[model samples]
Target: MNIHAAILWEQGAPLSVEEAELEGPRAGEVLIEVKAAGVCRSDLHPARGDWPTRTPLVLGHEGAGIVREVGEG
Candidate 1:
């Protein structure tokens, strides 16, 4: 499945809204449909190189969403 996500490909650069491929959930995993997200300093840290975070990271730790899919039990 493909889902729209904000990808930070570079530091101090704007996030790109792109369609990312989803490999689905593995065992004891679940998929969420994000309805709302929060904007915090942590998210900007990686975007501005304030934190030594990896590139091409998905920035969404503070958010609210719904469960869409679940992995096999």
Candidate 2:
């Protein structure tokens, strides 16, 4: 699925908003149609380079969404 996401291209850099392709749910997983998203302190920790992570990361974990599909076991 193609969706809009805030992507981190590099450490200590602001996230860039763009379209991203997502894989379908795997075993024991579900796909969500996101309704809301938020940036918390934890998000900032990595965004501001306070902590190190691999490049090209996706941000925003605090959010609300509806389950759209479920994967088979």
Candidate 3:
């Protein structure tokens, strides 16, 4: 399914909000319909190149949301 996500294309670049395709979770994984996502200084680590992360990474880690779906055991 497609969902809105803020993607970081590269270090020192502004985050781009786009529709992202989400594959179904694997075993023991859960799909969350994120309601509130916080952008804290911790996330800046990747943006500043202090923390190594894959390009085009989804920016939000600290989030509060409801469980939309759960993968099978």
Candidate 4:
């Protein structure tokens, strides 16, 4: 599925908003349709190079949403 995600391209850099292709969750995982996401300072820990993170990653971790699908175990 296509999703709008805030991608972190690099540390100390601006977040890039783009459309991303997301696969269904694996076993024991749940697919959530994100309804709300907050860009808090906690998310900035990695963005500011204070914490280590994988580059080109989807940045929203603290989000509220409904479960759209559930993967089988």
Candidate 5:
């Protein structure tokens, strides 16, 4: 699936809004159609280079969404 994501390509850099490809859920997983999302203090730690993090990271874990698909348990 194609979706829009906020990616931190580098430390201390602004997040880049880009198109991302997502695979279907695997075992014991579910795919959600995110309706709302939020970024908190923790989410900024890595973004601001206050903490170590890998590049090309997707942000915003706090979210509200509807389950779109479920994988085998």
Candidate 6:
């Protein structure tokens, strides 16, 4: 699935809203339709280069959303 997300492609760079490809809700997983999302301090650490985080990272793990799909458990 295609979705919009806050992505950090590099360190010390501001996050950009980009088109991202999302895989299925694999076994024991659920797909969420994010209604609200927030970029917390931990997410900033990677953007600010405070931590050696991998590039092309997705921020905003903190979010409130409804479960749209679920995979077989």
Question: Highest lDDT, which number?
Answer: 5
lDDT of 5: 0.95
Where in model 4 is the C-alpha error above 4 Å? Answer: none
* Model 2 regions more than 4 Å off: none
lDDT of 3 by residue, 1-73 (tens): 9999888999889889998889988899999988999888989999889998889888768999999899999
Clashing pairs for model 6 are none
TM-score of 1: 0.85
RMSD of 5: 0.8
Error of 2 at 30 (Å): 0.9
TM-score per candidate, in order? Answer: 0.85, 0.92, 0.90, 0.90, 0.94, 0.90
Candidate 1 lDDT, 1-73, residue by residue in tens: 8888889899889989999898988999998888998768878887889888878888869888899899999
Candidate 1 regions off by >4 Å?
Answer: none
* Clashes, model 4: 0
Worst 10 contiguous positions by lDDT, candidate 2: 52-61
- Candidate 6: regions farther than 4 A off: none
RMSD of each: 1.3, 0.9, 1.0, 1.1, 0.8, 1.0
TM-score of 5: 0.94
- 6-71 in candidate 6: lDDT tens per residue? 888899988789888999899999999999998889888888998998888888888999999999
Candidate 2: C-alpha lDDT: 0.90
Candidate 4 lDDT score relative to the true structure: 0.88
Better of 2 and 4 by lDDT: 2
Give the winner by TM-score: 5
Candidate-wise lDDT, in order? 0.87, 0.90, 0.89, 0.88, 0.95, 0.90
Error of 3 at 26 (Å): 1.2
